[model samples]
Target: MGKKYNRVLLKLSGEALLGEQGHGIDADILSTYAQEIKAVQEAGVEVSVVIGGGNIFRGVKGATQGMDRVQGDYMGMLATMINSMALQDALEQIEVQTRLMSAIRMEAIAEPYIRRRAVRHLEKGRVVIFGAGTGNPYFTTDTAGSLRAIEIEADVILKGTRVDGIFDSDPEKNKEAKKFDQITGDEVLKRRLSVMDLTAFTLCRENETPIIVFNMNKKGNLKRIVVDGEPVGTTVIWD
Candidate 1:
């Protein structure tokens, strides 16, 4: 099958790096992700990755427990940088050339984020990993992913979650929750579906960027969605 998306932004949760563990990165899962990403890269897809830091820290969660919002957010951003570094290492170990860019300007660990430079990296066939969650408090990695995807002019945002797709309700909490094969962006906003934060969702809606929420833990699913055009996820797009 022909490729459905030539270039894409992949949004991954920090918790996903844990694999079967409860905290931190799991070697096996990292290896699996590296392998899958390598396969997609070999298929001629340009990839930009944005990973969350929920497993290590979460600003909102910290605030609920009484931490200052800005300070908590900065810490959370650091967590994302840690995860990004781990992912970059894994990808490089598998022979996938990668560049880790940070919004927080850590020259020691990562290069400062520059839009044109990032796009150039992609053009050069290197996987670019974005870290530090927009370098701003009150914005999530989801928003960062959306913003970076738009900046890079990617075809779509592949939200790689543990769940197979978007559901009418929380599938883990309610077995009766039904999954949608496809849904309109307006409908998602109208129904208050939690596909992403309001800011991120609105950015995508206003920009006409489509999103695919799928189970990234599943082997071959990335190829199915990017190359084979299989309906493995709930697609959210302008109708």
Candidate 2:
């Protein structure tokens, strides 16, 4: 089967890396994600990743505790860098060439984010991981993912979550919540489903970049969606 997308931006929550553990990254989860990513890449999909820092630290949580908002956000950015480095290591271990680019410019560990360089890396079939959350405070990694995806002209944004797809209500809490195989972005906004922050969703809506929310923990699902062109997730469209 032909691939569904030429390039995609994968947005993952840091908490997804926790697995059964309460804190930090689980080695098993990291390995599984790396393998899933490798499968898609090998199938000729240009992939870029943006992972959240919620598992390690959340700036909003810190701010609620009276910490300076900017300082807390910067710390959160560093936490994302930590997760990015781990994923980079895991991908490299599996012989997948990758480049870790940081928005905040930590020269010792990551190269500073440059749009041209990042696109070049993707063109060469290297998976690029974007870290540090837009190099600014007050923006979630979701916003960063949308920004990067549009910048690189990715065909879609693949949000890898624990859930099967977007639902009308919290599927974990509300057993009767309805699931939509496909929905318009306007409906997502009107219903206020938290697929992503408003800023991020608005970016995608304006740019016409489709978003697929799917279960990344399910082995082979990534390949099925990207390579086999299966409808394994809920697709958010602009129309």
Candidate 3:
């Protein structure tokens, strides 16, 4: 990519923080993430993050079991707090300056979400993790990523996911599924692609924020995606 973009939002699912076997947070995984982030920061690229709580609480899973939708969403938001804390700690362990900002303030642990302050942190080279999922019910972390991307004026939103790229069919189920290297946001939604929720993609399209969906589980993928940009995954944008 040759550093086509300077600042980006790295949206990581809570599952991405968990290593193979996928139950609890893995120290090794956390360490690897810290190093990847640190390497990027050192390279002079400002990065912010939004972490999903799917590893701990997938909201729909609760709703499917009869939990009230709002309650389930709140549970999912809390799950994100746990991931945010882990990320903050992991980054700090590597001596990387970081800020954990929450939409719903939990004063003892993190600072309340402040757009200006968060921007300042990134400008000063601190990695910021936006947590608590828009602090409202019925909004996915995908929306949170879009919102933060706009607020921070990120060059792009890099959604770190489990898959290598967007496919016509579930690659896990269909070995013949074809992966797309790049596609427009409209095309993604037109085909009902798995890149992101429709609402999230809409916001990005409306605001002209490009998104990169790439496999986050592989070693060195983070750095590679930022640098090589060698058609690593599906890219959704107006351009």
Q: Among these predicted structures, which one has the highest lDDT? A: 2
- Residue-by-residue lDDT tens digits, candidate 2, 1-239: 47988999999999999998878899999999999999999989999999999888842474458878888889889889999999999999999999999999889999999999999999999999999999999999999999999999999999999989999999999999988899999999899999999999999999999999999999999999888889988999998
In model 2, residue pairs whose N, Cα or C atoms come closer than 3 Å (at least 3 residues apart or on different chains), thus clashing, are none
- Model 3, C-alpha of 97: deviation from truth (Å): 0.5
2 or 3: which has the higher TM-score? 2
- Candidate 2 C-alpha error for residue 24, in Å: 0.4
Best by TM-score: 2
Where does the lowest 10-residue lDDT sum fall in candidate 3? 55-64
Count the clashes in each prediction.
Answer: 0, 0, 0
Q: Write the per-residue lDDT of candidate 3 for residues 28-118, one digit (tens) a residue.
A: 8778778888877777789998999887774347455887889888888989999889988989988899999999979999899999999
Model 1: per-residue lDDT, tens digit, 85-193?
9999999998899999999988999999999999999999999999999999999999999999999999999999999899999998999999999999888878888
- Candidate ranking under lDDT, highest first, comes to 2, 1, 3
